[model samples]
Target chain A: MDEKSTINKDSENIERGNNIEVWEDVVNIKDLLLSILICASAAMGGYLIAPDDPQKPLLYGLVGVVIGFLVSSMIIKPKRTLRFEDEEK
Target chain B: MDLSLIMELIAISIFGAVLYTIIGIAPGTDETAVLMPVTLILVLSGLQPISVLAFFISSIVAKKLTDSIPVAIAGIPGGVLSAPMVEHAMVLKNRGLPDVSIRKMASGSVIGTLIAVPLSLFLANLLIPFGETISKYSNEIFFGGAVFLALMTKNRWLALLSIVPFALLIQGLRHLYWGTGAVPEDTTVFTSFFLGITVGPIILKLLELLNKEIRSNLPRRTTNDIVLKQQEKVKGFPNPFKILDKKETGSAAFSSVLGVFTFFMSPAGMTIFLGEVISSRIKDPIKKATRAISSMDGVTNAAYISGILIPLIAIGAPLSPTALGPGMALFNAPPVFTEDHNLHHILSMGDFIVATVIGAVIAISLTYFVTVKYSQQICTFVFKYIPHEALLGVFLALVIMLAYMDAGLINIGGVILIGLVAGVLHRWGVNYGIQFMVLYAAPWIVGNLVF
Candidate 1:
């Protein structure tokens, strides 16, 4: 009976660990997807608004893409966490 | 200034003070929303330049002072500028000392204004000689200010990086509007952008209610009873000096002076920055919190006043974010006070100085009286009768209406899109200051880089 209980506990621990990993992965995916959407939409917006000049549209679009990449990277890798407590103190 | 103009100034100041006090009492009403429309009306109505200046200055002062009431008692910020006071005020509220907190804020505002006026006037006079030179490099100045503001945020690199996307977003919208063969008013377009950003977080939270998972995880109010300290009523007019301790008074004055020099920075940023600086030097948490709250209020008033006064008196342009945002009408009221023919051109330096001082004095006096005597009753009334959802609904409706008025149907869509983007960034701790800087610099960035 003791041996059986130990085996069940080990399996439960593994299941919990797997759940945590899955949750983290989901969060990361959400972040990446949001970033891409923000960037793509911004680029599309620039392209749509640019004048009829062939080169200008492409250049504006490229600038938008660069901007999007920078924003997304920043979102993905935040430099520091903000705390309300810090301001209060 | 003439005698009739002086009388008109005083009358306008009083009217503005009373109107803004009521508006400031209600949470969710932004200074820009109130100031812009009213100033535009006054300007279009053919009010004298001194009268308009007096009205604008007094209204802003009164609003900033009374904004503390909602922040202290109910833990709801009166507006974006007042949001920083929530945490510190909440500390005092939980301790059943909200009365003390309100008193400190009110006193801080009054004292801060008293000290900032003369100093700012002096600085404005000194800076006036360089205004012409500065205007030439306004584009560079805006870019530098944007970069500096981003670097000062909590997540400096993230903020700096986000600026690129934000600026692109703004420029894209501008270009799109222009492409339609429509002459878009810069003020109207920017106003829509401002409203969108201001209401972004609320819109996001409202949308979250549609998701069951998010809704269930959200914190709900568990109680409605707001317990406040019941102090004995003191007779006659309340003195600010008596309410604030010597050390607290000193800090408030010092921070106010410092905030005057940073008029180009966002008022919200200055409040938090000054509060943190002051609080970090103190040892005890409770004492630190109290001092920080007072000085933060001080910074809010001082920064706002100096921001408007300095720019108007020195540069005759909306150089500071405060001037460009809430005080925009004073600089660029179409058909009446265009950018070139603004108050700076019409009013003399003597008129500016006298009107501002008179406006500040009367406005602060009235606000201080109302705030000190009836703050508790006001808080109790708002909390007991005013529904939070109702306030949110009204504000949302107002913003939408304003956006539609600004640029018809297309702006409404633009406002929502901008709101969504800003909402995401704000939730991640990117502040309005950085956003404002980016918006202001967007034209320059696009002109130099893309075109």
Candidate 2:
């Protein structure tokens, strides 16, 4: 089944080009760079925009992390496929 | 404690348990890298000390319980702690009993949590009288720990030789930060450098990816296909005692007790050692593998809990590898939790017990059930929706922001430089344990080097 998927799916991947694997999962390089930029800018933005307080900038930056994670999650479709088999008994 | 505070602790524990349960199943999330950032954020956000303690304990328990299930489902380990059990888990997976691996490992985790919490707290109480002595000599102790851990590594000579030089690099960076007035002289610029070590390998990897020649030669994959073995739905709340056989339960409990005692040593190392010793007498392949995974899971969980608890209760500093890595924020998030005034100084003995009990019980019950009953479903959701790039991006962004917060724009370059050097040393087999101890003892080692 795995071989069949790879052979049959190579045509689509050649065009879609989401073929790179990183940290035990598949990711396109362009998307990864875009996500990093978006997340980092947002985090820095949140930190710079915060009221001058010891904890508030850090809090806002953390909130920005969540927002960036959400945006990236929505825009990027995970490049993984799942199949389930009956337990071998 | 106020009723509201107690209620808040419970709520935070639930949130931590639920969150870590999902994070645990997501393969390849390193324990330190993922855990430290979140806990640091919580500490810096000004949560009450006890609430942060409860959340952290709950997260570790939940993380330990669910991390190994990925090994059963796929050949992949969920985190560094689970990496040792992969070989044993593969034995079961090959024999068509993958779900059995999940049940035993998770049950072992529950048992470990039960044994370690009380044992660790009790041990901490016995050591309280000596806490001051230990605190006074923390620098010497940390330097000693770095040497001890370095000698224990596979590349001992390389590890040993790297320690002093690494200490110099760390101290040199801080001195530069201070001399340039990038940060106030009193501030230590610790959190970002700590984070740099955790993010080091990624920085190296990302740079390599940018090289056209290296990129061309790198392994390419169209997709990451995950195959799952369907598990039977567990009826009612699963009982750990019933899930593990008598012998498995006995070995897991015994190893866990030892794990608590050896909290200062590497948990992964102890897990591999104790698992083999305990399971060596068993002859049957299936039985031996099962025993190994169960016992290994127990040791990993117990060691982690003890590593966090003993230091938090007995000493305010991070004296254990587990404490120094994932639990670093608890001891020294700076401004929020300084070595002199963290959880150890804030919470009473009774408060520690209450927070721990709530955290451990909630995590065991919730994560054990989810891991045993619906591992396949959880794995599916994470694989389908959670992109690895986003996780990496968030971690990278968090490190950058924290670096900026530490000193200013100039310190970002300092962190990247630290990350590059750390990455090279790490690739040379200098483990994180030695590196973290060096980080703790850097100023001392560098200061004492003066003629």
Candidate topping TM-score: 2
Determine the C-alpha RMSD for candidate 2 after optimal superposition of all C-alphas: 4.2
Candidate 2 - CAPRI tier? medium
Estimate, for each residue in B10-92, the C-alpha lDDT of model 2 and write its tens digit. 99999999999977875555687568878987988888899999999999999999888677755466766786687789788
lDDT of 2 at B436: 71
Q: Give model 2's DockQ, 2 decimals.
A: 0.57
Across all candidates, the chain A TM-score values are 0.54, 0.76
Off by over 4 Å in 1: A1-89, B181-188, B281-283
Tens digits of lDDT, candidate 1, B208-233 = 55577875565432223345566667
**Native-to-model Cα distance after best TM-score fit, residue B241 in candidate 1, in Å:** 1.5
Best by lDDT: 2
Model 1 chain A: worst 10 consecutive residues (lDDT sum): A18-27
| CA displacement after TM-score superposition, residue B84 of candidate 2 (Å) | 6.2
